[model samples]
Target: MLVVEQLRKSFPTAQGPLPVLQGVDLCLARGSSLALMGESGSGKSTLLHLLAGLDCADSGSILIDGEPLDGRSESALARWRREGIGLVFQHYNLISSLNVAANLAFQARLAGRHDPQWLDYLTQQLGLMPLLQRYPEQLSGGQQQRVAIGRALAARPALLLADEPTGSLDEASSDEVLALMLQLVGEAGSSVLLVTHSPRLAARLQRRCVLHAGRVQAGPV
Candidate 1:
């Protein structure tokens, strides 16, 4: 489970500091999913990054299964990110030199949780068995994203965070990828917090919240 309370963040700007998040609060139960929706400049991605520990919140706290997330050393945060969180972004971010199989196992191995059987199952579930030998460049955007999702789940992370994960794909492909992701996340029994602007996509999740003026509220749209 994840809990965020009064989360606040600001960034440097020519016009003094521009605040992005102001007392934002959210919670996601284990094995559940929530969609974060917001317009441009609404601080959705900022909150996601904070949760991932890629960036820190200037105020407030993030808790994963009751463990505090703020104020950790860089090394500790890095370790937590590698072993406890599974992240997917708009970009596939795959290693160009690595084949699909290697790409999928990369993070899992880093987390010291690699399971060949689970990897194989993921490959099968993602319809990627035949593409295991192929590289990122050889696949379409949808294929590459599936590989990204597989790689994230390969680590068996307790929580999964996706930021605009289907942003690059066509509408049909987006739906397909989202469905597949939810299915696999269910199979893995991992909680998911997906950041997306699409209401349709947001509605597909079990719950939805909107980020407005730096705070989280029940989705209005």
Candidate 2:
């Protein structure tokens, strides 16, 4: 469902243009999960941003189900971000003002793809039914992360982009959250591109690749 080809990106520095992603290429099939593993400063997050259209690649192509995500206008990129992908971050970027119910449905509502039944199912499966009325500030880190995952999947997006999504939680919490995410993602038939540092966590995904010197290298999971 996702294809990236010769993806290159560089950042401007006072000295020169520092290259981040140099001819990176990878692919993830429909309903499959891929773990992106790399050391610090290997550009995993940068790759994710480029794929999400939050940042542009200097040269390359990113295709989701044959739809190109490169060189689009800001508005078009915004629409793509809303309609095509779901993002989960380690910070749990929840709307503090909205309660759990609103936060859980926020992305779906934004994408104009809200499915009440699906939202309800996610809520129940994530064990969030009891916290529906509570605010983010009132919940634990695990609870907040669950809400974030629900919000991401609420739209049934074609791809889910997660960047160290369980980094802030304990091992038990992380395992629970990831298990739930994989379960729901499978049910939704969405592809996954997860950026993680833990080999144990990466091992749980369908495949794993390491980023080295700004390129993808197939390796042991």
Candidate 3:
């Protein structure tokens, strides 16, 4: 579903142009799950951003289902993201004023692809039915993260990108959330690229890749 070739990215620093990803290459099959493991500065999140088209790479190419993504304009990339990608961040990036239901439906509605039955199913599966009317501030961190996961899946995206999704939750909450996420992603038939620091979390995924020194290490899960 996704293929990246010799992907390279760098940012201007006081020292010079510091490179984050150095010729990274990866390919993700449709309906598969991959765990991206790395240290703090290993560019895992940067790689996810590049794959999601949230940021541009300085060089190399990213292809989604065989379409070249490197040269798309910002608007084009935004449209593509709305139609094909769903993102879950470490922090629950929920809108403060919007209630859970509205927040979950927001992106799907914006993409003109809202599915009421699917949204209902998501709410039920994520155990968010009772909390639908509550705002982010009123919910526990685990509940908010559940809402965030539901929101991401509401769009039925082809590719799901999760960056440290369980990082902020307690152990039990984290396990619950991760299990639900894995199940939901499997049911949705979407390929997932999840970035995480925990080995236990990484071990649960179907495949794993470790990022170090801006490059991906090849090995089995």
Q: Which candidate is the best by lDDT?
A: 2
Please give the clash total of every predicted structure, in order.
0, 0, 0
TM-score of each: 0.97, 0.98, 0.98
Model 1 — which ten-residue stretch has the worst lDDT?
Answer: 212-221
Model 2: how far residue 112 lies from native, Å:
1.1
**Model 3 Cα lDDT, one tens digit per residue, 1-221:** 79999999999999999999999999999999999999999999899889888889999999988999889998989898897888899898999999999999988997888999999999999999999999999999899999988888888889999999999998888888999999999888889999999888888899999999999997586
Q: Give the TM-score (vs. native) of candidate 1.
A: 0.97
lDDT: which is higher, 1 or 2?
Answer: 2
Segments of candidate 2 deviating more than 4 angstroms:
none
Candidate 1, residue 41: Cα displacement in angstroms equals: 1.2
lDDT of 1 by residue, 82-200 (tens): 99989999998999999999999999999999999999999999999999999999999999999999999998899999999999999999999999999999999999999998988
RMSD each, Å: 1.2, 0.9, 0.9
